[model samples]
Target: MYRYLDSRPAGNSSISLLARAIGKIAQTEGDHTTAIPALTLHRRNAPTKPLHCIYGLGLGVVVQGEKQVMLGDAVIDYGPGQSMVTTIDLPVVTHVARASFHEPFLGLVLTLDSRHVVQMASEMELPQPSRGGVYRPISIEALDGPLVEALARLVGLLDEPALLPRLAPLIQQEITIRLLAGPHGSQLQHLVASGSPSQQIAKAVAWLKQNFTRTLHVDELAARAHMSPSTFRQHFRNITGISPLQFQKQLRLQEARQLMLNQDLDAGNAGGQVGYQSASQFNREYSRLFGTPPQRDVRRMRAN
Candidate 1:
């Protein structure tokens, strides 16, 4: 039996059991929506094809199995007992690297509410950040006792529908509080804090997201964030780990991937729809980023 890292008397369960339940839940209800207000479970068999362009605002916690995600040039890998937090909209390639039918890759995704984070920061007397060193837009770390317990409570609520109505929100708040108190809390704090560089970058991000297909003028984006080009570029790179152009490329490619997956659009049309004018340039870049020519990639992805 695995040890219960959490010291709390109420929230305790074997990891194997929790993993089984989570896997069942994921298999029973596909995708993130099934988790409803608080958490979602994702399970898949071993050697499954990677899921492309998963977009969600949430915390990813692994109960069983392992995963690796690619964000631009950055790659993050996590296994059981670990978690990753996403503070901004990101385009990523997610791999379910380990699983079997009997023991599938099991994980829980807890959606983080910005409002709840802000309120927690206001009430809990957030610890003074010692250093101003930057943090990742997407961060990964080992889970703590408090976080595990909070997650356990959140999962337990899934079985008790009546309690879930009343308790999920409370437990969700508790989980966000725990995250805010954890190692990477400072980033979330800075994200919600007024005048923080991350907040400014978030504004730029919002603009890019809305106007992804539109040609961007850095001058206009800088003006939108109330900062000059030089400062905006520097801080935006710092917060997002990529330059503005790189971020936009990711958004465009992610959108293109969706169009190919959901619609019967051909590669050239999908590229054009995502603002890629030259078919050759689009095909080359698409291959470079997604590791295949558009048609082959889409077909392979669909086969998965």
Candidate 2:
């Protein structure tokens, strides 16, 4: 589905420049965003094992190499000169599909502001989402001229500290405007719509994030989202690619991992903190999700 476009020579140049800029600024492999707010730069020297992380609403530009993001059973792949847009918070297993010491993986990610998107959509008179279509929170497209140039210009600002305060916002606006007018605008339109089903599901997701340590009931979550249980289930799966219960489980497991790694909590304490009443049940579920028992996994993570 992701065919490489041959016609856009300028866009390719922009992508190359983006990769070069990121590689120059990022001395090592990690998020290097100290230079610009909400602008994250990443570099990897080689391919990696699948890693789980929570991806927020943002636009990711793959300046070099390819990556695969797995959400439930769906695998979304993107490569050089490609841009990925995700409209909602998602816990995904991501792998760097292509990279090497010579040509390391380089990427730039921009955190999108929902407020800016909503305001821009209103100003541009974008249409509301149609009622019948299923929603996908993430979409990928080939980079276009305006978006590529805006991103390149934004990264270029790192060298010009004085102009950044004044010009960065303008460039960011241009990038958002390009997205609003592009093929993925409708998806974003629904994401930021206040009372739309997508937003309602987002509200439910927010509640789940806040109350992950507590008991969750489908009916209660549906009521919080202002939808019937069946409708809520349908839209929740459609948008997030997972059930609400699974969503809460991911949050719980991730938090438990953090607690074990950061606070030096034992496996039992970590499990209890994340609402697991039975230690055996917690160990089983944690092994199922992370591919190891909690203590062993924590040991491996700490060693790395």
Candidate 3:
């Protein structure tokens, strides 16, 4: 166990309380999405295998235990008093790295609305970044005291239904502003800036996600983003840490997993629907990525 988990002094009292509140909320809500708007709580009693999904732009603070997210070759590990920020939607592998029945993992996730960020920055006169700056779509940083308190208050609202309607928006706005002023400010600024690489790649990413089943053509996607094939490929990899074809492959596999789990389609049918033509090829790729054949993975998920 980490020493910090056992040592919660006066300085970390709010964080300690926040962990308790998050755990209680997660217990009430189970592992499913709750009725608390964009707020979601997660509690895990044990470590888990790497799970792949699209991580949206959001603020996540681990009040207890730890987690790690893998993007290409980059591995980001965050623990208590630290926060994870994702500026764009990207497919990644993630897992709970540290947790146990005696001290379960507890955390909070809040979605970031770009519209709200723009409105708040305009109202506050926050300075925009220069025209060209490199950006990382995901980052981790220490949570300042005020940010931690704000998140705690936001989660605290879940207990008071009446206060939520009036107070939730204000707290969420505060969080966005704080993030825009923090170390990742330039990244967030470029997110809203017109014609920025981040914004351009975002358009391409959206198109790929919606049309993953179709054959991919880099030139066509580059034309859509107003970039040449080479430039588009470079910027796309910089922002998403994966090439366009790889991104589409992830989307296809994730969709196939859903079809198998929810719709109860056989492996061949599910793979075919996601653009896979050969059953043997689908089985090999599925096993390579998921560590098991599609049927076995789905059955394990159901059993648990």
Top lDDT: which candidate number?
2
Q: List the residue pairs that clash in candidate 2.
A: none
Give lDDT per model, in order.
Answer: 0.75, 0.85, 0.83
lDDT of 2 by residue, 1-304 (tens): 2322222223667778777778888879766874668799888888888988888888988888889888877878888888888888898999899988888899989998888988898899777778776567888777887788888899889989999999989999999999988877878888877788988988788788889999989998998888899999998987887899989889999999999999999989999999999999889989999999998999998887
Candidate 2: stretches off by over 4 Å: 1-10
What value of lDDT does candidate 1 attain over all alpha carbons? 0.75
Best by TM-score: 2
1 or 2, greater by TM-score:
2
Candidate 1: list runs displaced more than 4 Å: 1-14, 27-32, 35-38, 47-56
- Over the full model, what C-alpha lDDT does candidate 3 score relative to the true structure? 0.83
RMSD of 3: 3.9
Candidate order (TM-score): 2, 3, 1
Candidate 1's residue-wise lDDT over 187-299, tens digit each? 68777877777777887887789899999898889988889999999988766667899889888988898898899899889999999999999999888888899889889
lDDT for 58 (candidate 1)? 74
